[model samples]
Target chain A: MTERISFRSAQKKALDIARTRLLVGGALLAAAFLVIGVRLVDVTLFSENGPSRQANARNIAVEKKMDRADIVDRNGILLATGLKTASLYGDPSIIIDPKVAARALVGVLPELSEADVLQKLSSKGEFVWLKRHITPRQKYEVNRLGIPGFEFDEEERRVYPLGRLAVHAIGFTGDDNKGLAGIENSFNTALSERSERVTLSIDVRVQQILRRELAAQIKKFKALGGSGVILDVHTGEVLSLVSLPDFDPHTIKQASRSEKLKEEFKNQQFNRTTLGVYELGSVFKIFNHAIALETGVANMASNYDARKPIRSHGFTISDFHAENRWLTVPEIFMHSSNIGSAKMALDIGVAAQRKFLTDLGLMRRSSIELSEQQQAIFPAPWTELSAMTIAYGHGIAVTPLHAAAAVAAVINGGILYPTTLIRRDELPANGKRVISAQTSADMRKLLRLVVENGTGRNAEAPGYLVGGKTGTAEKPTAGGYKRKALISSFIGAFPMNAPRYVVMAQLDEPKGIKESYGYATGGWTAAPVVSQVISQAAPLLGIAPVDETAPNARRASAIKVATPRARGQGIATN
Target chain B: MKRPATLIIFGLAVFAGAMLFGVAFEVSNLEDRLTGLNKEITRDRDAIHVLRAEWSYLNQPERLDGLSQRHLELRPLEGRQFSDIAALPMRPNRVPTPTTDPVSAETAPAIAALVNAEPGGLPSAETPIATALTAKPKLKPAAPRRPARNVRLASQRISPEATTSTAASDKAALDAALRAIFGNTASNREGASR
Candidate 1:
């Protein structure tokens, strides 16, 4: 029995050896499978960038975000820019002492609420915000705190240092680092994503001068609002734009202010030269005469019956200080006779008139680059009454930018181009044609007649050959049009013989000034202001004085058709 | 056996050669990478220099003044001792061109040529046109009836028609004399300011 038991023990030992070998082989096989799986993951996630070789690869450190490109002027003036800023926050989960961190934080940022800070610090959140848009100084102070849980998250913030200057064109950004208003808002994608700098045509100095002059006028007149615009007609570039009762964009405390921000935008929503719509009084008459001449319905000596007020639908169309006689086209423009302009528009025909305005970019929203833009308010049905009122600068509203573009067409040899704020290479110099060259010349002569003798007399700037029109429209009140409250504006293009630039200045509810002899009319106010600005800026603009007296102006003037009575008188005299 | 041992030594030498080849390949790659980094640095430095120079050029205040001078006939600033804004006389109603018609502008009296080389009547289109080409009537800022050739529209608001609308002829006479002293415009206002 002993011999048999010993033999069984030996067999058990042999079986135990086989069991150990199987276990070791299985373990090795499992290790090989695990290695194959990891290698597969490595190939899928990263070839050279995988953890297997990541330590050897280059550019493996922190990535530097190439943030938003800056918007600068042609001369590299910073109109808009983004700066890298650090946002301070805390990991509440790691913060050991809530009271200690709160006390330390409040010391650096007095604006922060200590109770709120402590509450945030004591929260169970993995992350909590401490301060946003922290300046370098505040960052330095926070760094000095050296609190264990405190940290910084890199961020970018847009700041306008000039504040309110060119605010409409430059625009403002929203909280999430996006543009919400102006050029900033409109071109947000280009600015934030693109690496190339976006250059604008604004001359900061010119902008300052325009804003300064407009502001002084606003203050002097004690008006509710004011706007001014200057254009480089040849290039279709806006030199300066102004709208007042401005705001400091650096610090805005209220969200309500942000929505009403357009109102306080100085020239924000009021791109009077490009966006606001108003029946700009007599300024529209320039278009009327041009339309008549271009359509061959009127000549330089054509007569219009404006001897008395034409009372139609309670809109008495008459000239102030009435001539009470049949007036020539030049004389009519000089006198700013609505009755005469209505006649010119009628002769041009409604279809041709609408075509001309549309061609001139007056019947639609302007194509400028700014976000704040509006369509011109025109008669939907476009009735005969609409045509008449539109001819005399009534029954329509348009932005200043639109008017500027149209004015460019009037004096710029009837070439019209949409305004541009962005600086670009190779602009289309010859804009779309809105009228015949001969008609444009006739319009200029008519404009000169107005500045020389009519209501725009104040607009004459010696050698500048300045020609313009003045408009004073009573503001529409809640009940009816306010007889006293008015919107007075002057639009002028200098060196009218071959126009170079268009300048328009407007005063909203301008009070009668002692210097202006207590007259709030456009001639007494807006016209003179624009005339002065033009006269001062002309030589700077490099506009050489042409010898207007050089016998060319008479030749350029259309052949004056004589009246039958005048011809008969000449014959009789002969 | 000794031959087999010698064969083993040669195999060891081949293994060592392969290792050296791998090391050389790594060193060459590192050299290429270093060169690329150096090139990047150089390019960044050049960009910085160009941007700096452009910034300096743009910041030059003379650029604005130059542009302004090109666009406007801005007078050089003078010590108010010589000219005061408050002391200006009330402008005339219509300051049209005193010489409105080119016929009148051309009717200017012929003057003796200043330089022997210049043919004096009206400058030809080829010649550089200057207000100096026309003889100045006065050499002062405040003057009356300056020479028609040199007289531009005065910063004076009075249009030519308004020149006759003055309340007093005596003030006009005094203005005429002051213009005579500064009116020449031959002297560079920019130089004087500088």
Candidate 2:
């Protein structure tokens, strides 16, 4: 009986131990499951910091940058842009049958010589460029050949949409897309770093008009070359700048290979508007008269004896069409009397004339956004003769661009703003006031009278209220002036009531034509060009024509003559 | 009962785990699709950019001008063809009168024939409209020309002396017509600003 009780007790104790151990195992398994559930929730809902996600965001940010920016005109016309092109390259070491590959490439690109391609393909190099910037069509043609060793490298090529139309302004890029000239050269850094389009102030329509008119006149005159400029008088923005014999930037590099073509290419690449300096003849009288009136040296009523040629320092100063008579200030300007201008300059004296010309920005290189700017050729020793000659635009040589800017300042309320090819969103704050308001107004009236009754009569576009001056200077040779080789130019502004643009057209060495009655003067050669350009461009620019009979038109164009006797009599009447 | 309860909880946990895994796989598949679509979009954008550049190049002004000169009968707009609406003369006062005579209306057909026959040439005033109408019915059949002739006459009556108008007045008329076509709100605003 004692043995049975002990065995039962031992069995109960063993059962109790087994129950405790089972409970502990169940608790441990429950805790493990709960921990796994918590971990899943944390991973799905709470974890935001992952190294892979950050890497993805960083990669996207790095891919958005472009290699170059586009260049567009003021009206959002695309002038210069970059396009993705495929360039063919060959791995010489891996190329199977280099002759077959060269022959295939030559078939796709006819411009590529077989000898050159074969040499490149057979060279002992890992890689060599066969052609750079091939057209998509060429790339497709090449790909269709199934040349095993040849590969295409994607690149960007700068293209000018208008070709040679604004080639000098938009310029061209080198093999590696580096700007070589014009606004491209000037704003290379800005263009290379940004994808935003650079807008210039060039109106392509106006550029076409200017180029067409200048080219027609240049061809007609059989001249060496010509340059023209149309500037916004108020903003100093160059609307149109045309230098004749301009080259196509696309083919310039290829054309530069031939000796004769190379010479022509060099000539065509010369930006004459800002680079070539010439003695711009009676056009200087506009400034001369303006200076006299501004300095109180001469007034509208001031009379000068222009009855004979003024001989000073063994140099005879005579008008092209000599008016041997005493002339009023208005008459002197109307007839373009060189003697009277010299007399006026003598009265103003050399010091004042130099100061005025310097203030007008004629003594230094014009501040335009161009790399090819030449300083005006002025006489070194300021002599009385030099002042007299400069008065008639003889001793001073200035570029067409400089003349355009200076004239703009004179007519645009006498504020000289730096000329720019880029579009200006706001008026510049640093425009230098060079002359008084009264002088600018008087100058406007005088310019109108010259276009109306004087030598620039042909420059009038019926309702345009054209106002201008004629400049016919003889080109200087080794010893003296070449009378036949004349640099005839016309500087004009329109809607004289409120001038907005100043246009200057020059013909180099224009021969006398029969239609012009054997006269190759500014009025005959260049004035008509200005008239055509103004007539065509005014409508494009949305300038309204004014009725000549209107009181406002009369009031704006009317010049007050202090002397009543000089009013009815013609300036040329002796 | 406790053993069955444990089995049910374990089964539920396994099912939840399976659903979570399926959702994660689906999300991963959508993300991969999004990346592929983004790449395609970027490639398409690049192609569009290239196409726009080519379009500009092909639409160069000189090339268009050449093409027009060779294939189209159009010219650059002239300044003389433009004028301000204010410069136009006042319209003449008139009262409408319907003519019952078909002969008078027949003159319109002749004029229309003359206009079509000579595209750019103006009808000569020396050839009387009445005489020309009586002489030229053979150019086209006169059956279907009555209503067209009446409509032409009504348009012509608005400007009877249009052909004889001076260049300046013609320019002014064109200007007024353009202003009527394109509203004068811009000019009115300009005037207001001034």
Q: Per-prediction interface RMSD? A: 9.6, 10.1
TM-score of candidate 2 against the unseen true structure: 0.80
The candidate scoring highest on lDDT is 2
DockQ of each: 0.04, 0.15
Stretches of model 1 off by over 4 angstroms after superposition? A1-65, A253-271, A546-574, B1-194
Per-prediction TM-score, please?
0.70, 0.80
Per-residue lDDT of A267-303 in model 1, one digit per residue for the tens? Answer: 4345554556666888888888788888889888777
Model 2 alpha-carbon drift over 4 Å, by segment: A1-63, A560-573, B1-17, B68-80, B88-194
Clashing residue pairs, backbone N/CA/C < 3 A, model 2: none
TM-score of model 1 (first chain only) = 0.82
Predicted structure with the largest TM-score when compared to the true one:
2
Tens digits of per-residue lDDT, candidate 1, B45-154, equal: 54663464456446433455568779987663211112221122222112225555331222322111112112123433322222221212221333322223213334
A1-574: candidate 2 lDDT, tens digit per residue: 7899899899899999999999999999989999999987887678767646865784584366567888898888888888788998999989999898898888889999999999988999889998888888988888899878889999988888888888777877888888888888877889997666789989888898888888898888888888899999889898988888898877867865889998988889888898899999999999999899999999988888787898978889998877787788988898899999999999999999999899988888777777878998998898999999999899899999999889988888888888888888888887999999889988888988988888999899866788899999999889889989999999999878789999999999998888888899998999999999998899888886655545566665687644335444444453
**Candidate 1 C-alpha RMSD relative to the actual structure:** 13.2
